[model samples]
Target: MERSTEFLSDIDMVVGPRGHRRWPDAVKAQIVAETLVEGATVGAVARRYDMRANHLSEWRRMAREGKLVLPAVTEEPKFAALVVRDDVETTPDPEPRSPLDLIFGAVTVRLDAGTSAARIAEIARALNASS
Candidate 1:
């Protein structure tokens, strides 16, 4: 007597008899993108996607290490403070004026008691241009 053999399909291999929802690749990619590239807090993203923040963090770490590939996204630049000092020692005075002061000395514009709005506007524009 010959015996018949049966093989399990792809769906059966992924999902067993028990009903369980496995995380899809797209969802994992989204979590990584939002947490890493977008600079969103893992907790916030987790809450939005209804997943644990710890899990999302792990995925982010893995993606950073090249274990996974997340969608490309832009990130903001981080800045650091730098201090530079010169050999010249200059004391701070109550008033300090640069060379530009001599080029454009302070000019006072006096108007009579009855100065028209247009004339005042023109004077203001001229002053700005001089600067």
Candidate 2:
């Protein structure tokens, strides 16, 4: 391959006081909230806004701790109308779940179908204690 080096442009970002960026609280909150959308990732949001992933993660943590506040969505929630036709048959959304078998190091815990989280924790603790 022949070596060909071309000029690449750099993004011009305004450095705020003390050589650090001074993002407004609202902007930070918006960026953090974008990651909260279904199937959204911190890396994607960070890349879209051209900022560090760590910073966005930190902002999300701050929002969780009530340090930063995200603005409420202006649009009202809308739900798609469900349509039914006599010619069409409807199937159940999900089949009934079967019993669960959890296997750990030298231990196996079989749980009844639809076991609650609290019961699972209790079983785990009991198993750990017996060992």
Candidate 3:
């Protein structure tokens, strides 16, 4: 009974500082990634990290949104054995067209991807002045 009590006492470990425990993005991402392993559970991972499952979930969400940088794997990634296929289309497809393109009667103004509205307006004014 005394041994059981002693063991139980040791189970509760300090999570961190008393109030709000602020974890760095990198650490959160690493812990969140641990939950993705084959047999790992959120609850178990959270407990190991001394955090709540809900908090761990939030970290996972951050990772999904690219707010956190996941830790890199130590081992090189493995590739499947290359098998020669008979009907696989190996031809490289042509690159897709620009995302933003404006055409004003033969005047094809191909805007670069992520072209700002201000730049677009400037282009429009230049075109108007020429005509």
Candidate 4:
């Protein structure tokens, strides 16, 4: 006697909580890239994937925003180019002091003991400008 074989349909496939389905990652990536980068309609991708259009659309958006859980193919290079030994090192600007420094006596101020109010105002302006 010959035995009959049954095959599972696309609908029979199950999707996991982590967004992985019975379909291969490469296939899923192709579908997503087609819809997002290729500008293919969601309905078209959905038909190709044998899924609902809305679901495919949501998946595409999620993939674009990096919300989908997918395995990394290769390790991306940390730096695009290597720095030469002779290259000069540039120093970054120091972080600005807190505003409290201006309010409190943290900042040193140098002015003549008998300096006029106008002179003091000018000195304060210069200090503020320098800051």
Clashes within 3 Å, all models in order: 0, 0, 0, 0
How far does residue 21 in candidate 3 sit from its true spot (Å)?
1.4
Predicted candidate 1 versus true structure: per-residue lDDT over 1-131, tens digit per residue: 54222221322323446834365665577667877644578898777655578988888888888877887666568788887879879888655433221122567666664566787777777888978
The candidate that wins on lDDT is 2
- Model 4: ten consecutive residues of lowest lDDT: 2-11
Better of 1 and 3 by TM-score: 3
Clashing pairs in 2: none
In model 1, which range of ten residues has the least summed lDDT? 4-13
C-alpha lDDT values of all predictions:
0.64, 0.77, 0.74, 0.61
List per-candidate RMSD values in Å.
15.1, 17.3, 12.6, 13.9
lDDT of 3 by residue, 1-131 (tens): 22122322343432456645556665677778788886899999877755689988988888888888898766567788989889987889777756787766679898887789999999888888778
| Best prediction by TM-score | 2
Candidate 2 has what TM-score? 0.47
Candidate 3 residues lying further than 4 Å off, grouped into runs, are 1-17, 75-131
lDDT of 3 at 58: 84
Sort by TM-score, best first: 2, 3, 1, 4
Score every model by TM-score.
0.39, 0.47, 0.44, 0.33
